[model samples]
Target: MNILIKSATLPDGTRADLAIADGVFVESAGSGATVIDADGLQALPGLVDLHTHLREPGFEQSETVLTGSRAAAAGGFTAVFAMANTSPVQDTAGVVEQVWSLGEQHGYVTVRPIGAVTIGLAGERLSEIGAMARSRAAVRVFSDDGKCVHDALLMRRALEYVSTFDGVVAQHAQEPRLTEGAQMNEGPLASELGLAGWPAVAEESIIARDVLLADAVGARLHVCHVSTAGSVEIVRWAKARGIQVTAEVTPHHLLLTEQLASGYDARFKVNPPLRRDEDVAALRAALADGTIDIVATDHAPHPVESKEAAWAEASFGMVGLESALSVVQSAMVDTGLLGWSDVARVLSSAPAAIGRLAGYDTPFAVGAPAHLTLVDPSARSVFSVDHLHGRSVNSPYLGRELPGRVVTTIHRGVPTVLDGVLRDPQEVSRG
Candidate 1:
């Protein structure tokens, strides 16, 4: 459908009439085009999540590619890099291609499958990186996200190998030895609750080592879900030293903190568990100063049975895709640390560049691919499961008042979401 968005606010705070036709942004819309009153809405570049767990090809009970894509679209995302660690793991060319095809067939969001850096994600040896990269899927970002690549030699090899193709090795920086039986952020609260502590050093140490190794190998490295103040300092230092490194902070870590675990609500549970308020403050500062490159959902999902168990036995993840943008609005934009253009940079263009996804650098420009979202920044309401469009209901922000709503999301010139309602899959695919 040709689209004419009237009086939409651009990221730079200017108002304009935006036009989309034939799958690209155009200078004007024809008379037959669909007209959308975008008055009072901010038109942002479609968001790109560098890290997301769609849980398909194996964990469909949690989230299928189609359902996850719908969830992403509802959150104003145009593209999400689905993490490896599936049933067969996206380690081979066949698996990655299958995931890529599923996303295309689903037709809601661009699902770029992340190839596993190790076989079976066992950290035993490297996976078929070259084959997956060369495959039709064209996998570029590689990671064993659920499991950190603890072997320094293997980490070095993975970094060196991806650099040959100008690909990046995204590391889940956690030292295995220090985090045994860890449940939450290591602190007094853990002692009070009798839950095992996940020390900050466990995360910071590995990141420090990996950055040095990346520098030594002269390869690009991206750190996933950095949660500690010290981790931010290390990444900032690395950038100052001219190391090829980029880091991301999850929305949960930005607005929520370890105190939420006081009641043992497993919904608060996540890998690289929530940190102190000081950590959150530092993370916001780093992002504002451009030390943190982007915000990723790390949108892990699980069945009701998985999270309803005892805190110690429950799964460690929170479904974040549906609530990510609102959280960013509350934590960053409302706080006056960032403007809408910066939000576009962190949530869209930067992540797209890091994942090597093209066509996003010049967002909303005429002739550019028409992947964009319209947001009502004045909307404020308590978040609920009704806001979630995925198969899972594991979000942590339920009942919390959030500041923004994604009124419309256009993917490749198709309206996946319109007037705050997610379109049906059939209708979306037909477009």
Candidate 2:
């Protein structure tokens, strides 16, 4: 299959024609190629997410790899690292391979399974880290998300073990005792709302300890969903000290504040809950200055029953895959904190590098894999459930007007989305 994208604006503010054939970008399109007129569209390397939860093998009512991949495609993503906190937990070679195979079979997006750091995510015994790395899935990232690896010995061991395979240990970074029964960010807002507060120290303290531990062991560590100003300073300090640490900030944490919880809307209720306006400002600055290496959509999806209940009883997650890029564009790009080139780095290149996904961070060049997205930067619309490609409708920005829309997504030279509509898999494969 050959496709030519005409008059497309690159992220660097230059316009050029892009040609793809045999699943790779080429110098020119052969005769009789499919042509797409991309006037007024910004062509970027396909976005990559370092963290996503595609609830499957246990919680299919919420989401699956196929559905989540659709959501990723809708957001202009070509690859996503699926979290390991599923039913059976992606801990073993068999389970990780199954999840990886499902992504290959679906062919919507590249799904790299994140293996659990602990067996059954119990935080007691280590899972088959070496085995998972050696598995067909080639799991390069391990995490015990939804449950922090609180045991210092275990955390250290996990970091040391993965270092042997050039793998990274991604920590959820929440102190269990400090965050027990926590509902929202700890501050005057939680007091005013009469909800339990999740203190910043609960997150910052864990990050502080983990950074020192990572530095001591000379291993790679990644912090997930960094939600506080203090955590940003700590990561900055760690990096200054030459520690091998990387951190990510979620879109919700970047745009929304703890004030949203004032309405008692459970949709705003998330783990490491939204923080103060000052925290949001600090996170945006950190991302701009490179303290935060990537923007990840924790992309958690929950059932209606799980989200429509009392604020305390509702699940601690919001669906984010479909809205990630729009939120970043609205909060970061349009606000002058970042530009299109920076978006490509934060949303694509850096994430691919942190996840060790080879050949993904490469810029658009002849012979590179044809994985890219076309975005309409001028498009603006009030979001609705109709835009959701995943099974879950737990998005926090449901009625908010967000900037930009994904025009087309080409993964491996195959069109998964064209003109903002998801293409049929059968038709795409036959192209």
Please list the C-alpha lDDT of all candidates, in the order they appear: 0.95, 0.94
Model 1 per-residue lDDT tens digits across residues 271-317: 99999999999999999999999999999999999999899999999
How well does each candidate superpose onto the true structure, as a TM-score? 0.99, 0.99
Superposition-based RMSD of candidate 1 using all C-alpha atoms, in angstroms: 0.9
Model 1 lDDT, residue 320, Cα:
93
The lDDT, on a scale of 0 to 1, for candidate 2 is 0.94
Worst 10 residues of 2 by lDDT: 422-431
Candidate 2 lDDT over residue span 350-412, tens digit each: 999988997676767898899999999999999999899999999999999999999999988
Worst 10 residues of 1 by lDDT: 422-431
